[model samples]
Target: MKHILSLFLIHTFTSYCQDTTYNHFSVDAEFGLNNPIYPMTSGYDAATLNLWHVGLGFRYAVNPKFGVRLSGGYDNFRELAGTPSFSSEYYRVSLEGVANLGNIMDFKEWTKHIGLLFHMGAGYSVLNGSSIDPNHILHGIIGFTPQVRLSPRFNLYVDGSVLANIYQNYTYDLNSTRNTHGIDAYLINLSLGVQYNFGRKEHADWVVIPENNEEIQNLRKRVEKLEEMQRDDDNDGVANWLDQEPETPAGTLVDTKGRTLAPRDSDGDNIPDDLDDCPFEKGSAAMKGCPERSGSMAPNSSKEVITMIEESEVKFETDKADLSPSFQQLLKAIAKVMKDNPSYKLHIMGHADDRASEEYNMNLSRERANAARTYLIEQGVSGDRLTTEGFGETKLKNPLRTVEARAENRRVEFDVR
Candidate 1:
């Protein structure tokens, strides 16, 4: 008894000493009824049902699925009425192997509160009663316990067991001698009990260790990276993963790669290339980046040139800045007039319909004007003789929100000086 108490104390101390994911120790206490059968002298039968039976055990889990237990129990068997009455006291101590069958079979997949265990082992038992001396016996016991979890710390259980006694010296009545051989007696006990768990937040019996923890962790990292990539820090309609200029100013026009559409100035001119009449030449801003025009062409002739350029105004597809073959031909004609009047200079103005955001439309209009200027230059018109500007949707030729009206609005016209 002292040794048992010492062992219990050691287990308790160890259970509280370490922090772990799951607990590995538990203690059980139970009380119920027991019945004895066999090895009874004739005319000396014991009671059909006996009342006193109790058991206590300490368990240590080797892993989630298997463990061992040290257990002790006592039983009282009394003789039946109308017979020569006798009584016996039975005491037992055992070391049992325990299998967590519920975990092995994955009961958690179907139920959270139910569990089962199977235990079996061999032990020593002593029987003493009446005026008889104590009789020692070797016993083998097998049992099954079914349990329901009541809380994190407790489980309620019922156990049924069979103890087969070998080499018995006296009958259960304790009134006569019995065979000292194998399998001489049998005892059955039924008990209700509570198992108290110690150590850890979760018990080992209920923890399901993942088979591939590294793989799960890697997958979690990948999901986090994807979430980060999807964030749009500038709210520019472009994901961070694909945005080249993530911090572009609000309402600024951008391209598919998230770069600003504001045009560059190749020459050191104050005007951007899209609007500079002389993109590659350093010229005065007063002449629209062209060398001071030798002098102004005749006002009447400039008017005629301007009327011709306006009459041949080029229209573009919605949201498009590229010039069609027909529009290119019209630009060639205008370029010829500029050549004929060498002193004449043209100012190209671009416009757009109200189909998109202001900044987007503004960029689109500038590109249209630049396209026309490029074509005229390709036809031998000097860059310095042309100036360009964009009005976005502000100077709409047709204000009505109709397809034809919008189409008419998306055009480029010229003014001559």
Candidate 2:
């Protein structure tokens, strides 16, 4: 009993420095064998294997490192007669503090599936079918329980304990000359069991968002008002808030940045030179300020308009939809042409090289096309006047596997109707 208490104390002191993140509550049931080690005996009694014990227990943890358990059990010493021991049956109850060494030793990961624990407590024991009367006794217990974690909520454990009690008599009188009924005794017990834990969530770190604050709402309103105040709805020099002639034609001269001035026409044509494609030559406003082509002013076919747009200098950054200043300038010209020819609608097809996943490339191509569409919209072209499509590495301008060919494939194609 002294050795067992010493061992428990040594382990407890050494394990005060490890991880304590163990579960807080559990229940267990056990079954095993137990036998009395008669007082002053050096070893176990040589009895048959039939004697057994069964028990159930519940534990509540105070923290990751410490817990208390209430346990009750019955011991059947069926082979009591075969051995030199008394007390054929024993029933006991104890309340113990169990020290979790896994947490205290910092071995949680390496011992993820197993743990070592120690416990000590006091209890009352009932001794039945004993001679010399006085069958009830108070006992002290110390134990070592090793557990195997079987799941998040379950564990398998094997427990061993040393118990000390005072009994009124000994069934076998070692000294016939002395009537010593009041003596110290001991029992050695072993059990196999399963334990269950409960009540913690799988993930404990996710946070929920609360309602927006009044300050955030006020800031949003202020930003919207500032955007309205600074907006230039027309490409003309004036801001929309101050502009009187908001729908002035492209390139028309304006006064103090708001009102349009009568545009000069160098030629005798009724078309203003600023709006003329052929400013120095006689022209008609209906023909884009240009004279009739091949003696007639008829609209070009969709194919010709597409070819003209395809020749324009517009490019995108690699793997991105952002346009450069030069490309933005070209887009403004394209928007002007689209607005002047209201019947002509654009079909914008974006493409990507075979350098990424098909789905990723497809999305990249779509973003590029949308970028173009958005720029045209910002430049005053109607959304209905344009359509967009993405072809990811399915159509290549040059099919050869080379850097130049890949670059050529990474482009947008234009079609008009």
Candidate 3:
């Protein structure tokens, strides 16, 4: 377990630093021909083999690296020899693992959907045949399945598989016999099937809105009014009421207390743009928050990483612990950071597991949230910048667990802007 955890962390951190990838699931049904191999002594080639199979299955596209599928088929077998020889009907299950090549943009699912797929599993034929024994039919499978996405979230899979009995004995006596797993003897067939994909979606794809001149102007006017109320209209580091940096020009940054800070190059290089030995010299974050470049580079720019991060669990300590100083401090720091960075909002979604009394937990979470706001105020943060809510115990973090589960009962998390 320790080794596994380390490997998982390595893989996760590596993948996190890489580009984004997506996956999906699907189910399908199809029909195809089944040919059986008969011994020369029993009769001619096994053309009498006809297949009628109904399959129910699930597929998982693990990652761009690999994926898999599982399918169970119930089939009726018949021999097409001179006389219609009905063998037995049986259930067969197959699992296939596929490897994806380099993925293209449009064929996003193909990395998980399409690839070279190999199968290995056990199956059985249960019908009583004149010369067939139920215990003798140990089955094996192997093949390739390629998938194509016809539309977003809807995929098509076509596969060719080989299924056969492991024993060389084409003819089976009434007595039961065992066969080696890897070796193939009498079984042989080629099949083709298709499946439609479902589930995966691209919800985060941006929905764009053209610039509204009226709305922009309205927002500007609201900002002006907010400044007027403060009455520090110069927008300097010092407020008009306490102008310590009276000489400081307009457009200077102000702290929460409206105090001025020393002027320094945030993106530090020995040569500051204004008086640097080399203004154009590129440097590290230590010298300046900005990096000098041959061409213009925006500070906010980043390589987009499209991620589907599932919600995290929120756990509550004991009832009395809700009022602990540690808890208050935690909320205080969180609220302060969020208020300062208005562009990044913290989503305070409070939820509880089904074990709690709905009204009780709801009231409890609400009260705890009020405490959260008060602590933030003590940290010199504004209340209008935050919102809170309680979901009672309606949604569960894990339905499989009962009340004792940690984080299953209560939680909170943050999302990027």
lDDT of 3: 0.48
Q: What is the lDDT of residue 60 in candidate 1?
A: 81
TM-score per prediction, in order, is 0.49, 0.39, 0.35
- lDDT for predicted candidate 1 compared with the true structure: 0.81
TM-score of structure candidate 1: 0.49
Q: Which scores greater on lDDT, model 1 or model 2?
A: 1
Ranking by lDDT: 1, 2, 3
Question: What does candidate 3's lDDT look like per residue over 195-215, in tens digits?
Answer: 554434421111012124357
- Which of candidates 1 and 3 reaches a greater lDDT? 1
lDDT for each residue of candidate 2 in 102-219, tens digit (9 for 90 to 100): 6676556565677788899988887665443436777789999987877766789899998887552443222111234443677788989998664442100010111233466788
Residue-pair clashes, model 2: 2
lDDT of 1 by residue, 309-390 (tens): 5655788988899885445546755665577678888889999999999998998999999999999999899999999999
**Lowest-scoring 10 consecutive residues by lDDT in candidate 2?**
202-211
What lDDT is reached at residue 254 by model 1?
57
> Candidate 2: where is the Cα deviation over 4 Å?
1-23, 39-50, 80-87, 130-134, 167-183, 200-417
Identify the candidate with maximal TM-score.
Answer: 1
Ordered list by TM-score, greatest first: 1, 2, 3
